[model samples]
Target: MSTTVTPTIKHTALSDFKEITKMRLSLSVVFSSVAGYFLGADTISLKIVLLLALGGYFMVGASNAFNQIIEKDLDALMHRTKNRPVASGRMTVNTAFLIACVFTILGIGILYSINAQTAMFGAISIFLYTSVYTPLKTKTPLSVFVGAIPGAIPFMLGWVAATDNFGIEPGTLFALQFFWQFPHFWAIGWFLFEDYKRGGFFMLPTGKQDKGTAVQIILYTVWTILVSIVPVFGVTGQLKLSIVAAIIVLSLGLVMLYYAIQLYKKMTEKAAKQLMLSSVLYITLIQIVYVIDKFIR
Candidate 1:
């Protein structure tokens, strides 16, 4: 229940906190929210952007902290997670809880200062991740479906933060990310099947890297690409993309689809990893293209 490290290596303790927060993942999540902000913003303010980054990081960090706390013992059983702060006994569970509390309070408070709606969604994401998704991971493969709810919120949360309204525009942004998550997560689950099983977590839809799983990934990849290009046709509200931007976005989707199809054809860990990497690139570049096209138009 107590940390073994002496006070001489205080920096190590700080690093533990950063690890506990999953800083890289949290930062990446914030980037998506920021992209959403840019898409919806009429006039950008440095202050708001900074706040969105800070508040979003805090919310995601809080969620990660709580997740690590709950998964501490399970994490220790998995090679990839064995060295994490809580799992390795570098940080006491009480210390992690304290950090989670501080992050949660500051995160929601900052968003509340921005707008009540943003604060509400921020709270919802935290609640869903920690309470529902975390516990359900080991219990059912359906956890991915449940997890996608909170996962998709950050993208739309930014739009709501900017406009203070939750409507078709925000829903469209939510839908794009919602569908994209299926392939992205399934690819990781497919590649990391053994690691996740070691921790008693089965996240893949079919619970194995079989044709059923690969087919689902391809279908979702197609769904993700189609939803992304829909805005180009001006079918969705206020999310119109120029013809050139549409072409670029479609090309990116094709690259992602190519990888997904490869994964389906080979059903190999190597192909799954390739799909995972391409999904990361596809989501990030698509967001960038959208922002650039927004300004171009």
Candidate 2:
């Protein structure tokens, strides 16, 4: 006799969690956290590292989820974002909200297990990113500046989680990431200006893609390079970078600046895309350099 068997259906809700949180973006955030943790801890603990990664992912995921919820309408209007789960009707706003709440609470709890200061910073990051920066994106270009504060927090949050205090070391990490975001994001803004315009998002400080904006991008790129190399002087306390590492990092920065200048000279979509790609390479390489220098020094 053959017996009939039925397979249990997996709920779609599980899939929605991954989609809404932008798991890839959350992973990138966690990478920075892990890097900071390694740099801050003399002896790395796997448990602390795991906790930091989990807490960082939850906080960043919650922020991304809430961002999608608030920008659902605007997202629907942009080709790049039109298919987002919330914007595309794959998930309801109520479902997104619940997920965001759960992620935020879980993230804070995990960080609190590490340290109260880390938990506090994690909460602040979510609140600022979701409540202030996300809405401000449509209102003014300064929103990027507002967003940078929360965006830069993760790198330093790991330090605080490991050490349970805010000091010169974490401050340097924060400044480095904070300055880096301007060029990285403005390159993206330049390339996606039309799409952002369609969504009523003011990403460029000049409101239009012009020489002024390009010049600002170049200026920030220079500033990012300066701050990134400062650790070479051995003045940033625990955040010191060796001479060789500084040279390698500076070279990377100059290459990124070259792309930024190219974009500025042409002010075309293709050039902007190149600049954006270069910016990504710049941030990633510098972070890796910092990690390598920490171990080799």
Q: What tens-digit string does per-residue lDDT give for candidate 2 at 199-266? A: 99999989988999999999999998998898888788888898999999999999999998998889
Model 2's alpha-carbon lDDT is: 0.90
Model 1 has a clash total of 0
**C-alpha TM-score for every candidate:** 0.95, 0.94
Top candidate by TM-score: 1
Candidate 2 lDDT score at position 256: 92
The candidate scoring highest on lDDT is: 1
Q: What are the per-residue Cα lDDT tens digits for candidate 1 across 84-139? A: 99999989999999999999999999888879999999999999999999999999
**Candidate 1 clashes between residue pairs 3 or more apart in a chain or in different chains:** none
Local distance difference test, each candidate: 0.91, 0.90
Which regions of candidate 2 deviate over 4 angstroms?
Answer: 1-15
Q: TM-score for model 2?
A: 0.94
Clashes of each: 0, 0
